[model samples]
Target: MSNTQPLAGHVVVVGGGVSGLAAAHFLLEGGAARVTVLESSGRLGGKLYADEIAGVPVDLGAESILARRPEAVDLARAVGLGDDLEAPATTNAGLWTRGRLRPMPKGGVMGVPGDLGSLAASGVLSAAGLARLPLDHVLPRTKVGEDVAVGAYVAARLGHEVVDRLVDPLLGGVYAGNAYEISLRAAIPQLYEGARGGRSLIETVRESQRKAAAARQDGPVFAGIRGGVGRLPVAVAEACRSAGARIETDAPVRTLRRTPDGWEVAFDHDGTRETLAADAVVLAVPAPAAARLLAAESPGAATELSAVEYASVALVTMAFRRREIAHALPGSGFLVPPVDGRTIKASTFSSQKWHWSGAADSDVYVLRTSIGRHGQEADLAWDDTDLVRLSREDLGEAVGLTAAPVAARVTRWDGGLPQYPVGHLARVTRLREHVAKLPGLEMCGALYEGVGIPACVSSARGAATQVLGTLRRAAEPGAGQ
Candidate 1:
């Protein structure tokens, strides 16, 4: 594999989400002769959509990038959006449990507290629950024979109160999943590593914190585009085009097949059918869609991909007078535990979180509430008007605000998040093993590594690298022999 021009031939990336766009951009950067992106919808960004509400631009889909990881931020800068990257005004988060807002405890891994003093001060846990925490050190070392549920393991050590109140809300915010079912290794890798460490979970977390602090990682953990995260795809698509890549919206891939030279991709555009042959192919769509396209080629991999489940949720963005809010928003947002029995699971004070989201007059306040979760889809059945009403009702109850919203918009994201259940990593490993047998073909997205913006971009880069490696090997003498 000595060839310098590893990706010298045509490559086609299916799906126009951030992952696919990143893949196309990387392929072009890797010296591919040509790259084409096929997006089924009329739009480019799949889940990172941007729209205006009350004359203010707000993200209807993914709004933040976990800036701690360099993938998403680096991709943004590579696409000429470095000047527009903006960090949150505040990163403080709150927990709405026990009919009150409590400061989220610091030094917790997925809500598993590493410091006793912070947990005690936060008052998120009751006296009984707080008393149960010290028992973790005295109790015998809990054996994690294999992968276990995050809730089950944490509850065994720290008690269920922590899992229910702090952990559930945080996990739900990201995955829309139940903590009792989500995988430890896949969802929260740091916590999983700490759990397996020889020391107690608390000690393990404290040690991890010490290491991080010594590294002096000081900055906002998240970043967002000034306009909206939706601008990311547009910028990436532009970069791909500048590098001579073709991006086609309204193009849905129907089938993918292996050819003697490389791959044959079939798709539809504008009510007409067409086919394209490429030296390599990247499938960056959701798991279900990828499964359908791969069914004829590898049934085992397709079955595993089809088994991957998704969660749906809706966001209700509302505009209100800043003075109308009864309670002070000390933090960017507050997370509501499912145990709270509230209609909304979480809410974000967009104006406070990002400066660009705020109104010029400072009288208008913009915020959004999230509804529905992994096992909870009934709430999403309501129409937009009903959703807005329900969101307002919950907001009023939480903060005692009686004023009505001036304008509201409801955005429903069906199958927005992929759930990672126990054994998910194993299934992903098996899927990759099967896929490796098919040269010049690769896949990447939220279903595999993680569901965050950074993870998706990282996965896409990995797929592009794998395709490049395959191309390099094929160009080598006696590669197939």
Candidate 2:
């Protein structure tokens, strides 16, 4: 170890996804001696994967990152992807409800209506739903103790119609879980903070928009790499390797145990069992995988992790001859509310939304639709052909799009998104308490913080910071004595 790089000894990062790779990067910057990333799968990026359709690159996993949050975009720039970052060509999304695709009403926090006229204009809400909406202003404050499901609180203040047609689909897009079961505090803290004061939600969201707009924010709300956001993790991993981090793939970690000075990680490599000692460990896998690794060392934390649930989803990406559907597809895409009994939860017109995907082939158009959510994996069980057929059926109804695709690809993310039911924050807090009991240890991923790309990177950075702090403190004079 170099004297200048004085943080600590070797650190093994379990999980080669973006989180783990980014953790390694941060640890290296924070002066960790070495970071060995172990990934169970052959691929490194976890949910950030890519495949081409019609010879044009497309993200098979998450397509974009929330640019409003700096973590993900900053990470991209740090890893030499600064020039590749591109904002969506169009953000004119819609809500597929009431048998028509209407413009998604703007200036609301997660589909909570702020402007009644615009929402009413969109026709996303029926006449009955519209009538039931204003009741929120006159109704008594719905008490939210500690935490409450977003749908429950929204339905109470507004109405089930607002939740069913609007909030459900939007929350489904973010969480892949039922809105009625998602934790308000963990999911949307703005509303939770207001709920603490018993203020009307309409006023809360309205003021939030007002403040946001007044702030003169100049950038796009979201961003993606020119080719595909999937390239992000690949770039990050390369950066990690350049910084002296060793990344291992298809090497599944079998166990994690405490050591006198640090920790021991056991795993398989080339059909051979291998062990590595580390001064610290960063566990960045999903809840279940993390639970399994920590089961022996931290049973309480493992048990709590085991209780966290996940949702499965599949994306059907397709390409078509542009002339066949030119001028037919408009806006970015639309979100589907499960209440409408739609097979697909949401659709993004890739060619129309991203300039790179659109400019790739002038004659060909590309798009994708997502299927399945929490407790809704039955649709995902269908094979690629069946899944594509059903998704096309929904698309046909959605935008009258019936052009035969030149190529189609289905990407299924099984147990991908972690669910945040009511009390999720509390559960996470308790689990962290358990993890905190074990020094030289920390946890991060979509499970601890928000589930977006920025959130994941943010989580990784947080873990790296904690581990670096501990290592540096231990390196202090006579610290252990």
Expressed as tens digits, the lDDT of each residue in 332-439 for candidate 2 is 999999988889999999998999999998998889999999998898889999989998899998899877888999998999999999989999999999999898
Error of model 1, residue 111, in angstroms: 0.8
Tell me each candidate's TM-score. 0.96, 0.98
**lDDT of model number 2:** 0.90
In terms of lDDT, model 1 sits at 0.88
Per-residue alpha-carbon lDDT of candidate 1 for residues 1-481, written as tens digits (9 for 90 to 100): 1123535578899999999999988887777778899999899988899888778888999999999899999999988899999999887888888988788899877777888899899889999999998888988876674689989988998899999998999999999999999999898777687777646888877887888788765667789999799999999999888877889999999999999989999999988999999989999999899999999989988999999999999999998887887767668888999988888999998998998887434788888999999998889999999999998888777766567888999988899999999999999999999898888889988988899999999999999998877777776888768
| Candidate No. with top TM-score | 2
Alpha carbon lDDT of each predicted model? 0.88, 0.90
The list of candidate 1 runs beyond 4 A from truth reads: 1-7, 359-361, 477-481
